[model samples]
Target: MNAFMKVQNLHKIYGDKVVLNKINFDLKEGEFLSVLGPSGCGKTTLLKLLIGIESQTSGKILLKGNDISQLNSSKRNMGIVFQNYALFPNMTVLQNIEYALKFHETYKKDARKIALEVLEQVGLTEHMNKRVDRLSGGQQQRIAIARTLALKPDVILFDEPLSALDAANRLTMRQEIKRIQKEYHSTIIYITHDQEEAFTMSDRIMVMSEGHVEQLDTPLNIYNHPKNDFVNDFVVKHLQTKLNDLEKCMVKDYD
Candidate 1:
């Protein structure tokens, strides 16, 4: 079977500055892949291109073997959860999620059913009547996810969805996201600067540095053996704590 999605020779430029350079990768069906990088490394730019939020300067983005690089965001059948959760403050949680079905076929019959189903999946069934602004950050994020999943898109793009949350909220949202992904078996491309976040929840990680793909591999391999100097240095700081713990395990404490 072929990959569920393929990016070929992708490049994006802005005037004289290049933001993405000859990027390439394949995402398998139901795979959870995280794009990890520092700010301005083109991680968000890449996600934009993937979801058709921004047109690429050059290259092809193929979904299920058809070119979708030039397709409009709505026509791409891809869902995105923005960093801020992008919920409508004026709407209640159920209304926020049900809004995604407006133009969809499901809008005619039982839109409320689909919306409630997704709310239950995200553990927010009871809070459906509450306005999003009144909820905590983690709850808001779940509503964002419920809205996206209600559409049942072929692929999901998360653009630093937890970045705006506090440390506790971030941790809670992370586990919630992992649970939802596992339950739905959705193909997801998550973008984040947090190494622990990427390592904890991804099947594979694509490490980017200044518009280039430094490495693409499983989290364990990326942690134990980075592909290049950039990757090694990038992961070293995050790996130190794990390395120290392992070393301490070898030397039993006499307490």
Candidate 2:
């Protein structure tokens, strides 16, 4: 299959610092791809470039064979969910979702219908009447996602979206996001530092360090055959330690 979205020789620089260095990748249609890296590794910078919030210093961004490198964020046909749920505290859940659709030329006339539909899609229809600030962290996150889903963009970018949640909420939202993505048949580029989030949710994972890709492959392939020391240490070893700790807890429980 041809690439649904492609980036070639992407780079971002600030004065003497190189934020993203000659990066390149392809994303298949309806595929879930995660950009995993530690802080200051350019994961978020990559997202900003993809979503058109920031321009690349030099590169091409192709969406379905069309060059969108010069397009603004709204013209890119992409949606992004920030780590903080960017919601209106004063608005109802339904209104929060509907508000965004009002600005969308295609959905504006039917904003209410679209908002209601996405609310249902996120399993938040029952909370539609609640004020945004009144909901739990997970519920608020769902509303943020619902608002984005209302626009029905071609691709969605998630930037550490589950980071603010408690461990239990984070796990639950991970499942929620995966389910929503599958149901929507959505193409996703999820940015995260959490190993389990990327491994469990992605069809493919792109590991980056110091602004360059270390590896990009299926989660199983990455885990079993790391491309280099960075992949082994940053991805595999970290996950292994988590597994070891969990096993020790299980052993203690059995005793």
Candidate 3:
């Protein structure tokens, strides 16, 4: 079966520099996957390419088997939540989310109503009237997510969405994200440099390095049985500790 979302031979270059070189990957429908790598590893560039924020030098990005490489960002229907939340500081929480719906001709008329429902989904109903600056980082991130969900896009791309939050809040949001993804049955591609974050939230983690894919597999397999030295050295050195931490976070969701 073909993947619900696919990237084939993706490459990006700027003058003399190559950012994403011959990249290839895919996502099954409703699957939550992460592209894990360190800073400057081209993960963010890959996100940009996938979303059409920047066109690839050469490659194909297909959504449901249709080539969407040439489509603009808005046409792709891939929503993104940036690390900084990207909320309009002047807008209220409700307004920030409703702003996204205004661009979708179908939802433009019902923007406010749909925004309220999505806010409730993210557990932010009470803060609906709050100014964007008044909310906490976690709350703001939820607003970003709510804004994205309001679009009802084909795929959601999270560009290191949790990296800006404090550790405790990051843990909380991790579980919340998993719950929300399940609730929406959404297909997602999460970009992160933190192995623990990727391992904690993803069904599978794609390890990347210097514009190359090192390995792609379940977290346990990538951690316990790394396919290469970079995978072992960069992602597997902690082993049991990450597993313990991962289990503890999952357990916290029920507590």
Per-candidate clashes come to 0, 0, 0
lDDT of each: 0.91, 0.94, 0.92
**Tens digits of per-residue lDDT for model 3, 1-255:** 999998999999989899898998889999999999999999999999999999999999999989999998989989999998888999899999999788788999999899999999999999998898998999999999999999999999999998888899999999999999999999999999988889889999999999999999999889778999999988888656777888999999979
Q: Tens digit of lDDT per residue, candidate 2, span 1-255?
A: 779999999999988899999999999999999999999999999999999988999999999999999999989999999999999999999999999788888889999988888888889999999999999999999998988888889999999999999999999999999999999999999999999999999999999999999999999999999999999999999999999999999999999
The ten-residue window of minimal lDDT in model 1 covers 102-111
**Top candidate when judged by TM-score against the true structure:** 2
Which of 2 and 3 is the better model by lDDT?
A: 2
User: What lDDT is obtained when candidate 3 is compared to the true structure?
Assistant: 0.92
lDDT per residue for candidate 1 within 93-136, as digits (tens), equals: 99998886976875637789899888888889889999999999
Superposed model 2: Cα runs more than 4 Å off: none
Q: List the residue pairs that clash in candidate 3.
A: none
Q: Which parts of model 1 have CA positions greater than 4 angstroms off?
A: 241-255
Q: Every model's Cα RMSD, please? A: 2.5, 0.7, 3.9
Q: Judged by TM-score relative to the true structure, which candidate is superior, 1 or 2?
A: 2
